[model samples]
Target: MSTNSWDPWNYRSGSDFGTGHDLAGLSVQATDGHIGKVDEATYETGGSYLVVDTGPWIFGKKVLLPAAVVRSVDVEKKDIYVDLTKDQIKSSPKFEEGGTWSDTTHRDEVGTYYGQYDKGL
Candidate 1:
């Protein structure tokens, strides 16, 4: 498990949780909080900046976690978590069957909805 010093709900504005790291192959947790191993991550290509595969979390529901929405990462524990609640993730944008990432679509749907989350820092 990631052993980084992560404070509870540290994702609010002007908090240290916003400063995360590369998201490739990081562990993913489900809404019920079950640990789902990350299978893939799309970045810097095809407009997919932060596309990650939770395997089944996005089955018709592509829970796109914007760069800004991220809360923090525990490199030691090999985990990268977000700030959103279980319901939020479940209600986020939904992708196609066996689909990939798209920045334009995300910007229009997820980014526009989340706002300031697509601005890569």
Candidate 2:
């Protein structure tokens, strides 16, 4: 995805998938099937994301999903939908626990990985 994909609306206060509700613990669904649940989420204007806990799906690993990938949010159902498939999420860049996402290098690594799918790179 382009950097503009990270511009915030995907998870901003007044955007399509964004709302004034806590997203923690909400189930996350991929295009193909269920992936996990939101372990953490950020609402920063330019840097938003969902940190999903794959709970046994990936040996209890967590993956960071950029807000841009979020396709929709179902507040009533407590679910977040993304445009990617399980395999795609599974093979994306690994998220090291306790690592800060504010680090540009790490963000770039992740952005690049996801970008490839968007750009068909």
Candidate 3:
């Protein structure tokens, strides 16, 4: 673990996991089915998250998903599996693509939305 609280992207020490850059563009699937592809990712000391672009599936909506919900990553298939459903993600806190996301309020709202799931923080 890192002492830097603001470090966006958490990786276990001595692990072989790839960084956020490696996850971008990978398809993200919910428990039910495919939701979208990862537009970007942020890994904080608290946890990690993925910004997913829903494309035509959801009228080009973009959403933020907690890394805790992520069950697995298939590098060969370019896929990421999460334990949430499409509706759960659709109803989560809206994610704006600017500095507002860095706000503690926004982060808290997001955290609250997924509070039922393990944060893995």
Candidate 4:
């Protein structure tokens, strides 16, 4: 007998209603209004993140958002709510293509940027 257990329902642990794999293509909504659609997502032991493509709104700029900032996922509405504003996300650390997501330096930079918002600084 095989000892490996399979959980189709729990394919993604800690996921709210949908997994990171299912997050792509979903619209990302900031506190004020819709920001963009998810271009991609990264799921790791440390954390998850989404790359949102701000189509036309900001000249097609993209941004990275930590999963911690995700407030909720509405499958029916096909939307992901984040506890931030358009200006906040627009001003956040820009996500560079090919950048290492696991790098401590990068993580610290991003964490610090978002931390400032939490402190209202």
Best by TM-score: 2
**Cα distance off (Å), candidate 2, residue 34:** 0.7
Q: Which ten residues in a row have the lowest lDDT in candidate 3?
A: 1-10
Rank list by TM-score: 2, 3, 4, 1
**Best candidate per lDDT, number?**
2
- lDDT by residue (tens digit), candidate 3, 32-105: 99999998777666767777999998789887775556667888888988767888888888766675545676
Residue 100 displacement (Å), model 3 = 3.5
Q: Judge candidate 2 against the unseen true structure and give its global Cα lDDT, from 0 to 1.
A: 0.76
For residue 39, what is the lDDT in candidate 2? 89
**Which pairs of residues have clashing backbones in candidate 4?**
none
Model 1 residue 61 lDDT?
38
In candidate 1, residue 5 scores what lDDT? 29
TM-score for model 3?
0.74
Clash pairs for candidate 2 = 1-115
Stretches of candidate 3 exceeding 4 Å from the true structure: 1-16, 96-99, 119-121
Q: Write the per-residue lDDT of candidate 2 for residues 25-45, one digit (tens) a residue.
A: 999999899999998888887
Q: How far is 47's C-alpha from truth in model 3 (Å)?
A: 4.7
lDDT of each: 0.49, 0.76, 0.70, 0.69
Report clash pairs, candidate 3. Answer: 8-43, 9-43, 9-44
C-alpha lDDT (0 to 100) for residue 96 of candidate 3: 62
